[model samples]
Target: MLIILTMVLFALALSTIVMFISSLLSKKTIIDREKSSPFECGFDPKGSARLPFSLRFFLIAIIFLIFDVEITLLLPLVVVTKLTFIKTWVITGTFFLLILLAGLYHEWNQGALDWSS
Candidate 1:
């Protein structure tokens, strides 16, 4: 009990000290008109704020996100393959593959995977 209390107090003190040092070492910068101006692709300001963007950019981003999430879901299975539920894991993996292939086929049919004009 006493040891835990001491540890908590020590952690609090350490964090406070680190924060104080960081604050002292940091430089404060004032925001001016140029700094506050809207930035786009590192270029000068363009037309109105309601300017339209290419839908191809959005489609590519969404496809990348879908594949990214699929890879994330596959990582855990790779790590825990030695467990007792190997057959269950295999079935789950096959299901995931089927879903991924179906999505790929759909994208191909919709011309979403084509980069050439």
Candidate 2:
């Protein structure tokens, strides 16, 4: 226990020293304004650097990801069914599938599935 404590302390001290030295070395002596601006072939930029994002498309993507992961989880149940009794397997599968369906229904009811507003 003492040896482990000593090793951990040594590591902590070494990391702290390294971090301090790195911070001191990385300090910027001078800051330039033109260098930070977005460049456009030696000309001034016309528009903002950030682009507009579609929230509806993002919602659809998130829904697809959730359903995709849930479907993958269902794949393991195929092997589980072969190892378990018919009644238990049926009940377990039905419950899991129902959960997935219910989630889908909820999303649909909330109009999140609709692409056109």
Candidate 3:
């Protein structure tokens, strides 16, 4: 129990010191106008909350989020491939890719991917 407590205290102190040093090194004293603004999506953070938003943008964001989540799921397959049978891994990876491709194709067909309109 004493050893465990000592190790925990050491870990806590080490983590706190590392965090403090990293924060000090990376601290941004000057805030730039572009940096302060919201990301590429043009809606101003301080603007009217009731302003109408583009549905096309919303759909694009949803699709991006769906694919982002799928990517996260797919990343684990690289690690799992070592533990699972080669045939099983291949089948799963192929099926997942096919589903992703089909969804992308459907969205493209629906004109959700078209920004020019």
Q: Against the true structure, whose TM-score is highest?
A: 1
Residues 1-117 of candidate 1 have per-residue lDDT tens digits of: 999999999999999999999999876576555677889754558556666776776787799899999989988887777665688888998899899989989998999977674
Error of 1 at 5 (Å): 31
Per-candidate TM-score against the hidden true structure? 0.59, 0.54, 0.58
Q: For candidate 2, what is the TM-score?
A: 0.54
Q: Which segments of candidate 2 are over 4 A away from where they belong? A: 1-49
Query: Over the stretch 43-72, how does candidate 3's per-residue lDDT look in tens digits?
Result: 777677788889988998999999999999
Deviation of model 3 at 8, angstroms = 25
lDDT rank order: 3, 2, 1
- The per-residue C-alpha lDDT of model 2 at residue 75 equals 92
lDDT of 2 by residue, 4-111 (tens): 999999999999999999989874644555567788534557565576667888899899999999999889889888787688778888999999999999999999
Model 3, stretches more than 4 Å misplaced? Answer: 1-41, 44-47
Query: Which candidate, 1 or 3, would have the higher lDDT against the true structure?
Result: 3
Model 1: runs farther than 4 Å from truth?
Answer: 1-46
Best-fitting candidate, measured by lDDT?
Answer: 3
For model 2, name the residue pairs that clash.
Answer: none
- Residue 58 of model 1, lDDT score: 72
